[model samples]
Target: MRYIFFFFFVLLTLSGCNKHEEPSSNLIVSSFKLPPKNESAASSDAKDEMAAPASPEIPQKIIKEASLRFETDNLEDTFNRIQSAVTLNKATIQNDSEGKDYNNIYRNLTIRVPSQNFDAFINAISKGVSYFERKDISSQNVTEQYIDLTSRLNTKRKLEERYLQILQKATKISEILEIEKQISTIREEIEAKQGQLKYLESRVSESTVTIEFYKTIAQKEGVKTSYGSKIWAAIQSGFYSLSEFLISIISVWPFIIVFCIFAYFIRKRFKRKKK
Candidate 1:
């Protein structure tokens, strides 16, 4: 009975110890012990409003520009459409030539076409030719170029405006001269860029097409000759030869006469000395 009472007393002591050592279930535990909210509701609302969706950023004015080189075998057809292409593309023929050898006559032409219709224009041009001698199609993505031009132009324009304003406010002639000089230089640069843009626009507007063709040698139809006609031609040629000979002799008659007179005098002097 004493052993059972001691066992019960030991169990009660363990239970009381466990109750004292137990962790509080209501106590909050977290890895990140963050600070309490100090920001006002309006401030939090403003932050929420400022946050934006993860939308892909769009580029401004995506410019399309390119250049190409193409060669064709059917030069005739190529030439025919070449003018039209130039007009359509606002371009010009850079080079064109046609020549003949003993056997053949070949034609060569270099043309520039527009960039907007570069591919479509090339397709149209290819259809006109028999076959391509060589098709060298290339593309230079000039989005960067256009963007660069725009930036440069904008900056230069602002500079130009500033210069104009300075010109208006100038007090001294020297200052005016210096400003004018600077303005001139800026204008020259602007003109150069404008020219470049025009050229690029023209290139993009038109495609360059180089055309070459060789004419095939054809057989002679027939050989016809008459004996009477040949004789007549010979007679005419002989008469012309005789007239030329007579004219040549007559031309030098004065010199010939002088030589003969000198010769006669020398002979007479020799004969007199011998006598």
Candidate 2:
């Protein structure tokens, strides 16, 4: 009877161990609940369940931009207004250049503004242009990019915090060095993200004003080329050709000398044979 009782107890213990053992890839999103405050062991079990994952949860956010193109007649005034609007919007100018086309001088301007004032600033800029040659406007939806950056930023921040915590709690010198290295990488990533955000803000604030100045065609008086100038050009060309010929002769002198020597030796050999 005692043997039977011992065997049953062993079987029960084996079954309990199997129940407690979790799978290698357990993805538990929600927290496990405890029975009661008195069940401290159960609460500890729930806490252990939460702390099993090696990686921290990353939060996602989407970053996007809107592009605008406008043409204007009042180049000077429009440029001034654009600069002012950029200042007011707390943004910066990214690019400002003149377009290539002699007949029509076009100014291409890029401004970075805040996301909130995107539509308003665009509308304000549109009002300034005399004639809208071509207005091409579109939104670059960076949903994935934003989400990825947010996730990475969140992860890095968490890592930095954890490293800081480790720096305080760490006892070993090796562990402290490792934590510091991680902190450095995280800080770099944070700074890079900040720069990216700043750049985006500057671009969004000011609308691109490609001011093309169209000049009316006037009858151009043609000046005849002077006889002396034509003569000088011809002389210069002749001098260049003469120099090129001299350079070519100088370059092939070694080959020419070798050929001459060979011919002389053949002539001497033939004379000696005839004699």
Candidate 3:
């Protein structure tokens, strides 16, 4: 009876101790205490501010491009002038080509310049040019596109950080793999957005200009075709016609011979009748 009573008392004491101590789940909950009403309201405001980020000031981004085609009497002089302008504007010549067409000897240049000096370079090139066969200037605004890419990139970076944090806390290999996959996807998106942003920046920073100038062939040689050329062409045409006639005659030589023999017999018959 004494042993049973001691066992019952020990069991009761253990149960009381368990009731006094906090459970694992409640201990976790108690670690983070609720703030007062005023503090809570301030925290909520802070969260609202964080959730809605302020819009960044976006300077206007413009891509400028121009193309000009004209006629120049002296190619060397005009090219020298353009080179001077290019030097003054700190421009780079991407491509320089000279070719002769049917009626003109032309030179084409592709130039890249700083966007800030685009106008100055254009004006410098236009100083001595009296006429242009074609002149085109275009401007494109990419501010919105740039801002969008930047925002998306930032968001992806934040998402990747969150994924990394989750990966650290993960215990199972499957969970880790899944989190890593998500991180990889987010990283790819971030890289792509960064690339787009870089492209936009490059375009905005640099401008492209294409210039084509040509000297007309008529200035050097007034006549397109001389009388001798016309005579030669006519002779060539006559020779070609003669060649075609010979080909036609040879194409049906047997039929031609047959017709000739029949005509000869008929003529002889007529002559005999006449006699």
Candidate 4:
């Protein structure tokens, strides 16, 4: 009976010790444990409101661009008109090129205007324009891409923060080095995302316009040629042809001599056979 009571007491003591020890270790692990994945996802935008835009419907990101090519009577006048429109709309001229092709005089311009004034600037430039030789206008939607990048950047930042927290608690040099490497990688990724976001914002804010204006030269009426002038031109053409033929013959003089000699010998042989 005593032995049975002793065994029961010993088992109880060991169970109590285990319960106490397990809880302490579990608490330490839980303290260092990361938050639940669901929580992390839900709080994606909580840390940074810029991750997602406030309004769901408004403020869509759109990039606009246009290309215009047309014929103009006067290049200077067309350039001046575009300049006036650019000034009126607070637009900027990025590039200006002027050159002539065949019988056409052309001027090309690249302009950047605010998104709000995209259509207004186009209309302003179209005042005296009758037709467009080539006109291309396009718009791209980047709302989803912006949102995606913003969200990803925010998430990476949060992860970096977590790693930093763990770094603070880290005691080993190896652990510190590894965590810092991860932080560095995350920072690079963050910078890349930031660059992408800025590019998108720039495109969405300003619209690009390319204008090409050209003038065609009309053909002049041909003058009547006098009879004497026609005779002189014909004589010159014949002289030039004769000179070219002589030059060609001179170039192959050795071959021509050989062919003539062979022909003479064959003629002599034929005459002797006939006799």
| Residues 1-275 of candidate 2: C-alpha lDDT, one tens digit per residue | 99999999999999987777654224352355544443245334444554576665433332334444455556677678877777776766777786546445467666666666666776676676665555665555444665455555555565566568869999999988887887898799888986775664444434343333333222241124456678899999999999999999999999999999999999999999999
RMSD of every prediction: 15.6, 15.3, 11.0, 9.2
Candidate lDDT scores, in order, read 0.66, 0.63, 0.87, 0.88
Per-residue lDDT tens digits for candidate 4, residues 24-127, read 99889888946557636535645555535664564799999999999999888889999999999999999999898877888999999999999999999888
Candidate 1 lDDT by residue in tens digits, 1-275: 99999999999999998886664432435345664253244334434443444545324332333333344445566567766766776766788788877766677767665555656666665666565556666655565686567556555665677679989999999999999998899899888888877776655545566656565555441123456678889999999999999999999999999999999999999999999
The TM-scores, one per candidate, come to: 0.46, 0.42, 0.64, 0.64
Estimate the TM-score for candidate 2. Answer: 0.42
Q: List the residue pairs that clash in candidate 2.
A: 63-146, 111-203, 112-202, 112-203, 112-204, 112-205, 113-204, 113-205
Show the lowest summed lDDT stretch of 10 residues, model 4: 218-227
Worst 10 residues of 3 by lDDT: 36-45
Q: Which has the better lDDT: candidate 1, or candidate 4?
A: 4
Q: Candidate 4: which stretches are off by over 4 Å?
A: 1-58, 221-275
Candidate 4 TM-score over all chains jointly: 0.64
Candidate 2 residue 247 Cα shift, in angstroms, is 35
Worst 10 residues of 1 by lDDT: 60-69
Candidate 2 stretches greater than 4 Å from native: 1-133, 201-209, 219-275
Candidate 4, backbone clash total? 0
